[model samples]
Target: MDSFDAIVVGSGFGGSVTAYRLAEAGLRVCLLERGKAYPPGSFPRSPHETAKNFWDPSSQLFGMYDLWSFSKLDALVSSGLGGGSLIYANVLIRKPETWFVNESIDGGYERWPVTREDLDPHYDSVERMLDAQPYPFDQKPYEDTPKTVAMQEAAGKLGLSWELPKLAITFARPNEAPAPGVEIPGGDDNLHHSPRSTCRLVGECDLGCNFGSKNSLDLTYLSAAQRRGADIRTFCEVRAFEPVDGGFQVSYIEHRPGQDGDPAAPPLRGAVRARRLILSAGALGTPYLLLRNRSAFPALSPALGSRFSGNGDFLGMIVKARRLQEEGGDGELVPRLLAPSYGPVVTSAMFMPDAHDEGGTGRGFYIEDAGYPEFLNWLVENNVLTMSHRVGRFLLRRAWSAATHSPKSQVGRSAADALSKGLFTATSLPMLGMGRDVPDGRVFLREGHLDLDWDLTASKPYFDRLNKTMGEVSKSLGGRYWASPLWLLNRLITVHPLGGAPMGRDRREGVVDSYGQVYGYPGLSIADGSVMPGPVGPNPSLTIAALADRSAERIIDDHRRNPAGRP
Candidate 1:
């Protein structure tokens, strides 16, 4: 029966950050992650591998993507050791100061217990640890990244606040020129023990950077935790936990590689004891676990499953922006080259002020340029009509050359056009938008599966305002707004799902306090997006990591005072 000073579950932003800090404080910490660790050159790329890249243990699949489809909307989260950072775009935007509304909005929901001032130092610390840096638009090859340029130019025309937000990517070494495929130059703390190179401009951030160009948590915080002797275990999924004398009892199952997909795989049951338990299993994960094990937590807060929000996420597309001639009106339409698949997943951001801003107006939000893996270009470029015409032209040229027996060595241009007629893919841009929407959704168990009762009932106005602004930004680029097909059905997808075990002044208000200590369970804490009282109105990753860092401090303080688990 081995006992740990602390047990951290789910190595996402919250878990990895907290685990490292706790280990650094001299605590014997054991970090548990449900999914496999994806080292450099291991992330799936080909069609066969991508098909199996999802998380479903019952079906014996242990992939990273954990997608949940509810009647209201869909939520996408990761299941790897580094958690969401495995697939996140790497933007490190802090929670806006004004946007952290303390005053209650539409009831007691979304009343944050902590303010930006409280988390500022923590934010700074996290930024340093992640090695955050803005996209090097000032550098050579990166200088002419088409979508980044288009986003900045459009925002200027619309009078919106736009800037290159710091991304968790290693485009270049410190004081070095930004060059593709250069070795990152350091190995003392590299967890993967794999060789890494600088960003190659392949636009594969979301798919998982095979070159290790992204400064993901696995390469940063988790690596530090390992160096500090933290017991980091992957493929170990926590199944149950509960309070006990002198500490808490934790139960989990070891998901061996081949057994992960076997429905009847022999259960590899295991359990441990910990003085303190920290659940960093993310918004959807933590809430689902807590709800399923509610019987064990007799005094758990009633607010456990309340205040679920999608962070006001909306996806919009601007396809084939017209390049108009300056000398004439409505003369000719040429597809502008935005190159949606050239750079990282996100390069620059545009901030739209809401009612909460300084002399602001509508619902607050952020719009960032979204990108995908370059391989997707093949999928998007397969326009039947366009390819048919190109194929016809190439065949006709070859036919004419053969009939005349002419040595037409200049058919190079014709051959090139046959492969890719790139109007749709070259000129299209996807915008990732998220903001402060009404936090009125609920999470509960239905028929033994996690279910969410959420809709746009309270957030319709916010959604309307967000979509309209996106449309204006699209028109600014001489393109038409293309709403997501899911939005047409009154549903949207959210990558930044937040708020489940929300923090509050007390148990009556939320499941945890400002320090992430569960109100009724003192030694048990939560350090993840589940603690967010409302939306962070920016990319939620940095804020989640910052808050977890703050939680680690309070945890260290508590452990020092007690020096032992509760009796």
Candidate 2:
């Protein structure tokens, strides 16, 4: 078995940042990922192929919105070597300034342990690594997408504050790569290494970007970490950990591709040792791992799974179009003003008044532009009119249809056409509403499995506020608003799930201390969204990376001060 100075689990924003830092610091770091390391060409372009892409069903489920099957709420996450970063839209946004201050006493929610002052430098570092930049609105022609034009006009009429969104992308000189180590040049910033190819704007970022334009961790931090001598093993899932005299022992399963004549082969068991352990398996995965290891670390806080929140995120849409200039002709469908699917998942954001302050009746939603890929469009169209209970059947039928008839239907022209229409329509744009979501839920282990019990009723005011804002904005743009029926059925669906093992001054209020060190586990640490205490008022990836960076730095500093302290 291989031994390392540190073992970091998961390869998303948190684990990648920690691995890079630790390896650069001259530590032997091993990153264990439960999914494959999908190279640029490995991305599945067709719906048929992509539909088959998912993590092991025994250990986790990828597409379902519910964290646990029993939960009424909806949560969307991904599993792979780069974790959710593999399929995540690349939008990176810093948490709002006010989000750092304590809001618990104000009847709003839990407070963040570290303030803006403590996290700014880390955020700056992460931004540089991810090539974060503001969208170049002036360079591109603006189109009248439903959400973009509507919000702009609404903000203008209402005199509300707004601006073109910032994004993390490489849109520099056409057909050129980013100059080595040369920061994006002024006026012609190259945010990603793949500057040679312009964002084709295919709107399939979520399915995975075969174009290599996205600056996902696999291309950025993980690549850097590998160069620094970090050992990354993919398709290796860690089942549990046991504390040793001076380090830890990990048990995992090694999965192999199925043979041509056989069904999927059973995963083989394996074990390894490490001087330290870092859990970055994201909010969902991380908690489950810890819960499963409760016997090994009996001192873990009772709050291990308490106070779960999802930033009250929701998705909606508005579609409108102008009559073509020529009869029986398609005028250039309005180009998407916002890079819907090119840049980070969320390039822009807006803030609204807190629902709690408005007698808990207003909709507190942030409206932003989002994009959909061809496969998603196909799914939506085929299942849009079907009854809710029939969705699963519809998906299964569609899957079989594509498999038998058009093996490439997943990437078929229809998918692409729908995506183009969805993004180019003069009156179509996605509205991503995010509001304050209080952490009023808990995660627990049931029969050695993870389960979530979250309370979303308290979030009603925020949802109402978002709907009202979206309605007004849509009206201003001469369009109508439409929300996903899923929201009505499931109550909410969030891409940003945060808070479980939060940071605090002591173990009583949090599972980890201010520095992210576990309360009693000396050499164990957490560097992921699990440390957030409450909603961040924006996308959580940037904040998660910054916090992880800061934690890694602190770990290094602590080791320097006491060589024999913990390990």
Candidate 3:
């Protein structure tokens, strides 16, 4: 069996940061990522490439997108070296300090064991490491981004505070001016060892930034860890773990990459021992692994699989926004010229304060301008062709009648009008919302498979308020609004799944303490979204990393204080 000082499962924000911190402290660390590494320009774009971009070990398909379905919700998470950071929209907002509420709930009181003050320093460390920056909407070329302008207009008309949230993307090199669509000069140092470039504004952040513009874990934390001599093995999935003498034992499966012109490969079993083991395989993965190996840690908290939440995540769209004619010649409404697929996945956001603040409502949530790839825009444009054809027929008749009635013809104007009739897609935008929702959901092992028992009914009031705000924003933009397609069918879709082995003051309330140390198990810890005791009220990535930073400090201190074990 292979041995190490520490082992980190999953290479997302938590795992990557922990590995880097531990290795930087001179401890031998091994990071086992279940998915393969994705270098710049390697993400799938073509139909054939996209078809194979799913995670299914049984079918020997190891790809980025990992899709999961449950009775109440559907989830889409990334399965790559950088974990969800590879596919997530790079928003790095911090959790609101006042939004950390302590309230009674179904299972127990939903409270945050660690306060925002405690995480402030750690948050700063993560922000500096990520080199976070706001979208350069104030600069030329970017200043006229249609979707961002539309969202700003909507927020302005509603008298709301709209701001561009900092993003983990590389728009320019250090000390250089902001320039888009240029090669990032220092691109050779990343873990993937691929050339990278600045943002091309292709609206592909969520599908994985192929240009390496996004400052994902693979480029930031994991790269630094690798340079610090940490061992990072991709395509190795940890199956189970158990505490043992002076350390812990981890069993995993190594998946081999296919050779040239062939895609068939076999999985090989492996095991390793570590003085410390940190489970950071994301919210869903960590809890599932713990539940599967529950018998090994018999004294774990009962709240291991409790407090699961979608982070109050909700999606909606504003379609067919009304726009004025070109050159402002006439007052008649025309199809909006704004293109939702022209910027990063999200450019700007509006925050809705909670009741704690004056003149605010229930729980707070953020509504951001969501975008998609140009391919989706092309698909949307294709769907409007039939509508355009019908309008073309109508315009042809009008032109024919005018020509027959008058010596001079207005057919040119009529033809131009026909061509501009169908623009529903170019005028539309998607809004993503996530805030403090009831963390009442739970996860469990059923028939040796992971199952979620999450119901959105408990958070109906929060959802209703969030939806109303979204509708108001859409209405202000002169467009029709509707919930995400799955919402109507009573199903929620979330990319930011959080909580499971939540942090608490003691074992009675959570599986881990404020430092993310498992209460009863000394060397066992969890450093991921699974440690969030409640919803982060924003994009949880930054907060997850901050918490992991604190956890790593605690782990290093514990190691120095008691090198043998924590008996």
The lDDT of model 1 is 0.89
TM-score sort, best first: 1, 3, 2
Comparing 2 and 3 on lDDT, the stronger one: 3
Candidates 1 and 3, the one with greater lDDT: 1
lDDT of 2: 0.69
RMSD of each: 2.4, 8.5, 3.9
Consecutive 10-residue window with the lowest summed lDDT within model 1: 258-267
On lDDT, the candidate that comes out on top is: 1
- CA lDDT of each prediction against the hidden true structure: 0.89, 0.69, 0.87
Clashing pairs in 1: 60-260, 60-261
**lDDT of model 1 at position 488:** 88
C-alpha displacement of 244 in model 3, angstroms?
1.5
Per-residue accuracy of model 1 over 366-465 as CA lDDT, tens digit each? 9999998766887767667867888998899899889999976777788897988667778889999999888888899999899998878788888898
Model 2: per-residue lDDT, tens digit, 38-134?
A: 6555677666665656554464332211233446666777777667776776777777665565755234368667888888999899989877766
Query: Could you estimate the TM-score for every candidate?
Result: 0.95, 0.81, 0.92
